[model samples]
Target: MELKSWFYYLITHSVFNFRLLIDGLNEVPNNRDNLLDTIGLIAESFNKVKICCSSRRERLFEQILQHNPSLRLEDLNYEDIQKHCYRRLHTTRARRYAYLVTEELRNAVNNGDDEVVLKRRLGECPGEMHKLFTSLVERQDKFYAKDPKPYLRLIEVATKRGDNNNHGAGAFLTFFELLVASSAQEEFISRVPKSLDASLLASLDSQAPDLKANVVVRCANLAELVPNRSDLQSYPKEFAYKELVNADSLEVRFIHRRVQDFLTDSEEGAALLRSYNMTEQNAVIRLTIASVTRFLATPYMSRVGKSLKWESLIEAGFWAKNGTGALDIIFPTLQARKPLRMPPFTAEDTSINGKTPPFNVLCPQLSPLENVAFGFATGFAMVAYTEAKLRALDLQKWRLVVGFSSCLCVRAYGLGRESSGFLTMFEPYLSLTSLTQNLTLSYILEPFTDVDFWVFRHLSCVATPRPGFHQSRF
Candidate 1:
């Protein structure tokens, strides 16, 4: 009764129009009578208040609201449904017409037709998505008639897929990463310098936007440059170097997922690949080479120190893992670079480390390529172990070894061992390895006995040093 009085007072006091919407009133379990009374009150105050509600056609509600303005959804919505269907039908026809215009315009430009002639040829014609894509590809081929390999290669990289339809090496490449990858390709390598110095890096950074635009044009609009959300600020400041900032904050992706799907469909994709004379393996290898080249060019101290950059390191490892025989090609190059020296350990150093030096101190510095390889191996191992744990599956022996190895690597890199505690970091993997393998502590200690040996044997095949280069101690 008090609720009814309050609602009555509210409706009476309402000076302007009041609109209320109640959905699924039939779903209300209790207070059916009170709700009906509220509706009656709203009807009495109809001049100032308006209420629209939806409910099942119950007998009680029908008797009360039958005389008032009422609508039967089942009967009254037909006109609305017809209007929606008509709009969709018109939209489909309009899209077909638009596609026809695009196709005709491309042909006209290729034939060097005048604007007047092109305008006349813009009449509606039948077309489909597959036909439109084919037309676009053909236009690109004609545009690059002299040397379409680079154009084709970029397309192949953009659409490359892995086993089980997973994203391949070229997928979701950032603007800078794609530029580096393109430079490493066979056709473009001679044209663009492979090595990037500080000045060159800045120059490329400045020109990144224009480079991206050229890339998109070369790919015939199938690929596009998208903003990199990770690099963007929630509320960006208005500042100078805005162009450079925008370039850094962009990534390359297909304009739409549908474009990727259409291009990567098994039958259509194979035909396209054969037409371009491109292979997924070759594209991945190029990406791997680019990654390694970039990593080698960047200084080690710059990579790990205050000016740290993980892009090259992470990319090198990822591409190398995916590219068959990539390590063989990059290992020599890595060794050719200047070797890292191991710092001398002294009693004072040991005393400062509390009888035992930290892992980073013991391992010292690794060659750029070795650091990438180790980081990749350890990171991959941790991911696999985590997935296995989540799925409640049997932990593999190799995973245990690699997981333990990763803990050591984490410590060696000074990532989080000190603050998080060594035992806390190592205990889970150590305990799991013991429980699952039923191995004695002696066997567990054996792998760490010769860190270099196990790391080379299990984690990577690039452990063999060049004739003149001494391999860094792990």
Candidate 2:
């Protein structure tokens, strides 16, 4: 059967085809003459069937429907828009706060069509989805205006993940890491808009010479800021929606798909997000650097392995290498006194401090002799050279090893002919023995395995450790 004839057949001859509704006809496009002609054919062919077509105001559709009864839905849908905002607010993480604001908007907008009041109310409670999204962005901007680091950090994250419309929304965890990354002084300094000026950067550097000191505090503050709430709950109150969706997953997402689309697809929304002098290219560059930092620092090594495929890591590295300026800054050489250990997976690990220690524990007994020797021999010099040649991975972790090894090497080499120095010289072999003991569990796994394999290879070549120096991994 002909395509139109088939459509007509289904509409006219089928048991459930008495009514045919064609909607959103105005979205078809500028060259809509054929669409109008087709609609006219369908309408003209209908006798027993009832046709109801809904569309936005368009000249061609209006000309076709000149004599037919039609209704303008923009006004009617305005009320629906109110209901939608109300529903979205109540259904969201900040329901209590949203309800209060939405109620105020409802009362203000509904009280006798005063134009000025209506305009103000619209700003607060948008009468359209796009406007509602815009209003939300404005609200966040106002809220974060005083300390825009977090908000600016958010734009950097979302833009880096690609537009939600094109690549879909990123997981909350992804945003959280990027947010923490944005706080890195090296990364931020490299991309801080010239408009912010060198003076501001210098001032920030004076306070936060090392990014780690303030990174945790900044992350905590940002956690409270986004999916933003006006006031925080005194006690922890988990949202119902978060519970229904896997709340354990740190996936940052837009509240609604349309909201996502608006931010991604609308020029107005992009402008709002990039209102800062920073460009999208610059924002993404900072985000990539931040991500590499966050990944190294996070306690989710196992999770990282599971979540990030080899391709994903490669792609992440590629973007970082190409972002903003070409290779503006490398990951800072980490200084360490102790090796960072994985937190024990057990029930007793309940206390925040107990669950997450400031420094990771290392088994020097598990390192290879050559790796230990090289690490103690050259310190950061060799590690820096190796890092310069390698791709983006956990250069930070290797730096920690090198830093500690260098420190121990100094003490060992300084001891001269002491027995302790001799013992320390054989420490890597002893560590090797311990590693072989776990051969059944993990075949000849070196302590360097804790660092990324690709990174481990780079660091292992220059490896040397004598003994006895505190080591800390991110």
Candidate 3:
């Protein structure tokens, strides 16, 4: 039957023990307003039977419930929680060690009379979700005691896949995407076991297909525990990439949001993660950087790729700015010199000699100085990308410097090495001079030379300046 028919049926059967219960009403992704209005109408019209709805404490949900009387459900009390813990901890006599603390906790709670006394007896029973998750992991400690690497690797994939900063709804990855990223991530984590040594981490081969495949197999085997599937239907169809990922294996993320919070927020969770040495998670960030760079390097880009590139670039910039020395690690890797392609040349005239046709000339490779400049440009661009709004005034300075430097570099290359050396020394002082600060006057003097005009123009291309900045160019 149609939605209207269902509603009508429910409304007619109002007093016949009829009830409507909805969970996660606020989680409706698309047409949330329309859904809310419909629900509100049903709620207002139906007065006899019970109508109960549950939702996260998102602003919209709160706003909808503002005028209505509602009761906030607290976490399970001490005795109830102990019972739950005991159930999870219970096992056969051969595996009896698991129940030792659980039994003790149960007895302790049973002995107490008052709520306060029971709470004291339970003694830090991990009342919150984060603590609860931590307790669950600790319970499994005995099983993973001999080798925690696999377990730690699993947790990392599950937790790190979501937002660590507690912003937004967190990342939602499909099973396949998670599998690929996790495989790569696990390789990095296990490079040098039981250490966060930057040297070992830096030396790790992030490009190993064999290692990734191995990890993927390992993770797949342990799928019941780590990176477990989120509620697939909770997400909207548009939000989910069911077609791109396997239909049979369409998964969302980290069982629930509390699980994400437990991993992201708990001190014990943080320390546990630190023990595994998450410095290697840097590989993922570097990979993200490479993604952006590759897009930028492409000669032609589709509309989707262009939009994605912009997002990737912005994310890379954020990672560099606030990612706790991620930039430091990535910069050296990015700046590391690669062999530059030189123009093909021959030592002697091919027609005159019966000797081998083409002899390789001692062609110039990219100098250390050039590589350093490129690195600096890349780093500065990252900073500019993040601080475009917050530091709009400083961005003007950035534009001038980038544009002028671009011109100088071009001129030096176009002219000769001797000219490059001379300009290199004088460029810094010229930029610092008061004359270049007057952006409007500098444009007016464009007839004299294109140097200043070129600098202004180049900056505009690199970053779209704000309202006032655009006007300053004239």
Question: Who wins the TM-score comparison?
Answer: 1
Question: What TM-score, computed on C-alpha atoms, does each candidate reach?
Answer: 0.41, 0.31, 0.30
Q: In model 3, how many backbone clashes occur?
A: 0
lDDT of 2 at 331: 19
Ranked by lDDT from best down, the candidates are 1, 2, 3
- Cα deviation at 429, candidate 3, in Å, is 10
For residues 164-186, what per-residue lDDT tens digits would candidate 2 score against the true structure?
43222233434334443355546
lDDT tens digits by residue: candidate 1, 10-119? 77776777888888876777888778887787768567777898888766678777888888896978999778857876786565545445645765676677655766
* lDDT (Cα, tens digit) per residue for candidate 3, span 340-412: 2222223342222333211111112223333333323322333333233223335444434444334434433
* Candidate 2 error regions (>4 Å): 1-124, 136-170, 174-179, 187-253, 277-285, 288-300, 306-474
* Highest-scoring model, lDDT: 1
RMSD of 1: 20.1
If the candidates were sorted by their TM-score against the true structure, best first, what order would they fall in? 1, 2, 3
Clashes in model 3: which pairs? Answer: none
